[model samples]
Target: MDRIKIKSVTTLAEHWGALRQADVEYRAADGSLHHLKREIYDRGNAAAIALFDPARQTVLLVRQARFPALLNGDPAFMLEVCAGMLDGDDPFTCAHKEALEETGHAPRNVRKICNIYPSPGAVQEKVALFVGEYDAQTRQAQGGGLAHEGEDIELVELPLDEALGMIESGELTDAKTIILLQHLALERGA
Candidate 1:
């Protein structure tokens, strides 16, 4: 096995917003030196949560139009989980808000499951995952998605098994959602 040693990392260009460019030098294990240049898109960070109503035997999800996925021809834009960018706020707070907005369901119980990097190649975004347990009866239909932010989300209620099946069948391609749902399934011994 060969390892690459990072000699140094330098920021080449930076914007006022969340994306930038960088350059780095590394020493190959075989004693060769190399330079790598790439753009760094800093999304600040984000969080996602799986909201489940055990009493109702249902899970909350959202269907939103994803331009990239649409371009890729995935008609099933439906996804499982509540997710959003941190936006300079606490990850837990952001996750809670995203859950309520995306599903119109306020969670009574929430737990942090994991934090992950969905794509480390270009986007410098880290997603913190959560599992929220709530009473479906108390949910409201308040139209919680943010259209100004380019979100036209449709709330969805699905059976646990069906949601899991979607994961297996590749209907759910969001990485953070997958991580949370997989953890939920494992916790329930499903």
Candidate 2:
């Protein structure tokens, strides 16, 4: 299908000093007039990276408290890859920094896997996904996370097979994490 033509956009409200409620008019493929009410978030785009150590047969995942997951009835804390919002930095650089801060791992070979829009319907957050194969020996810190940001992440090293099992059992709930795992399991055959 071709792109829809945006006829007009009007701001209706703003919330959290960041979210914007807007009304938009557009012409669909069939030339029908339609209006959409959307909640837009002016969030800076972000990136996430999955790190694997083939020799160790392990993947480094971060465990953190997520309010949404907690409220969604997930008893187990999330097991996710390193991720953070971009801040006037390149995707790879930001991902590398996130990995260090969140998992205490310095990524050696970061490769872009894909870019995705987490919530195109309402939010303007975009995620640049990456995969990295890193040396697992440098274990400088235990990855208590960046304390100043109130981040209390614990880096968990799981065997690739166990991580894949977590994915199949719906234990890993984070979308970007799941995407990375799926890519590894299917495309890379890792």
Local distance difference test scores for all models: 0.77, 0.80
TM-score of predicted structure 1: 0.85
TM-score of 2: 0.87
Best by TM-score: 2
Cand. 1 Cα-lDDT: 0.77
Model 2: lDDT of residue 36: 75
lDDT of 2 by residue, 1-190 (tens): 2444444455555552267666667677787877877767766799999998867767899988887776877765788999988888988999988988887778776899999998798778889999887665645555667888889888788888899899788788788998888887775465
Instruction: Give residue 61's lDDT in candidate 2 (0 to 100).
Output: 92
The per-candidate count of clashes, in order, stands at: 0, 0
Clashing pairs in 2: none
Q: Candidate 1's residue-wise lDDT over 87-163, tens digit each? A: 87799999888887887777877888878988898888888888888674657656448768777888778888888
lDDT of model 2 at residue 140?
A: 53
Q: In model 1, what lDDT does residue 141 have?
A: 56
